[model samples]
Target: MNRIFATSICVILATSAAAAEVELSFYGGVQSAPSSDVSIRDDDSIPDGDFSIAWEGRSLEAPPYYGIRATKWRSPEFGYGLDFTHNKVYPENDELPAGYDVLEFTDGLNTLTVNAYRRWSSAFGEVSPYIGGGVGVSVPYVEVANSDSETFSYQLTGPAATWIAGASYPINDQWSVFGEYKGTFSSNTADLDTGGTLETDIVTNAVNLGLSFNF
Candidate 1:
């Protein structure tokens, strides 16, 4: 039993050490802004619960999106990856007047994902296309951006689903360019911590361009 346990521990440590030696900074991608139907409200103050106090999709809009990824390829046809991304925009309640919904980073969403993929080769390894899926953690801050006023924003987290498909064309043995489609589905509700709740639905369809390197 002791010998078997030692063998297992050695195998795990060897795998971890191999991963640590790989070039970690090797991929970057850019995509269009994500789309979500997210809104939050205060139930205590607004009895009607109409457009007068809700921020619609417009609040989640931001400029083009970019992300960094760390991936490991165990073989020529398979690999695992993790992604971190940020979309800088204010989450507002568009239903209210112009000035009432100007909260920044504190109300926006942050996405962290982990996934695995299998690459298919064709044309004598000249082309590689991949399909993958993973789960994501969608976190929304609970603090408001209003300086003069006080409104707290909190979120109840839920499962986020992701799917991706892409193709890469090698420029050389060390570099390649690729394009892909990615989508996410996450449904959650934000609590104002006052008297209102925001039904936040995040469903984003995006296309992306990526540059990859093997070092």
Candidate 2:
């Protein structure tokens, strides 16, 4: 996964030389996750079981939800970029199996994606509407604890993908403000401290407000 991410960065950098404009953006927002089934495999203390998880996204709490993006525009209508998002999830304790004390990725379910974008001029009066999608990987700070063991560290889990729709209004030729809706899907399989594995597929949705600077 590290190799793939590095390769993507190289590709983005190579493409930048041909770009007509470069834009950097920063955003903060609220995010949420839907309930999903979690699978546990080959564990010593706890019996293996498939359980339903009700996820909570405490976006305003502690670490917070945020994103950064760098785009290389080839023209006014077409572009591509790299986007990094810090998203998190916490399972409702009542939903977990017995003896499981902690199960969450509160630190981050970090996603880094390389995306292609398309924008339309004057889609909403002075605002420009845009859409984008990308493929990447999830590097999450997995946090799991039980009576016999605990696992707390970042791991490269698996494939992740995202789609976004938004509109931006120019404050000036060099600056703009925007709002957007984004959705992401991540498949994670993390190692447990006791030599077991826990797996889950997560779908997250977010609404964001942001500012962008073009150079």
Candidate 3:
């Protein structure tokens, strides 16, 4: 994870140095996930089950929800960038299956994406509205504990995607504050310690407030 993050930062810095209108932004906010179906399969050491889990975001807790982005605009109204989000989910305790004691991705359901964005000038007085969408991959820190086995590791699960709608207010020529609604979808199929697999598809929605530096 450290190596991946470091490499991403290097790429962003290199891209920013060569870009005409580049912006770096950081955000923190509340996020939530609706209930989703979960499937657990194992040939030995655990029971197999298919059930629904009510996911809790607990965004304000330790390890929180946050995001960072770097954008390079080709024109005043259009741009593309890299966006990374640290998202998490916890299943309701009562929803756990017969053999499982813990199942959650509290550290991160992390996503790194390449997004395309479009902005409109002064749609609400001094505020400019923008929208974006992207496709990426999911790297989640899986935490699963059962009666007979446990697994805790980061795994590349599958494809992930995001869409955002937001507006910004310029604080100065080189700084701005923004708020946005962002949604992400991820499909995960992860390996278990018991030589089986767990699969689920998750959708997360977030409301974020952020600051940006433009050059």
Specify the highest-TM-score model's number: 3
Clashing pairs in 2: none
Error of 3 at 206 (Å): 0.5
User: Model-by-model lDDT, in order?
Assistant: 0.53, 0.85, 0.89
Model 1 residue 5 lDDT score: 26
What's the C-alpha lDDT at position 67 in model 1? 46
What TM-score against the true fold does each predicted structure earn?
Answer: 0.63, 0.89, 0.94
| Candidate 1 structure, TM-score to reference | 0.63
State in Å the error of residue 159, model 3: 0.3
lDDT of 3 at 80: 99
Tens digits of per-residue lDDT for model 2, 83-187 = 878898998544567778888888888888889999997556789999999999998889888777788988989999999999999999899999999999999
Residue pairs with backbone atoms closer than 3 Å in model 1 (clashes): 40-198, 42-196, 43-195, 43-196, 44-195, 54-95, 55-93, 55-94, 142-153
Scanning candidate 2 in windows of ten residues, the lowest lDDT window is: 1-10
Q: Rank by TM-score, descending?
A: 3, 2, 1
Clashes of 1: 9
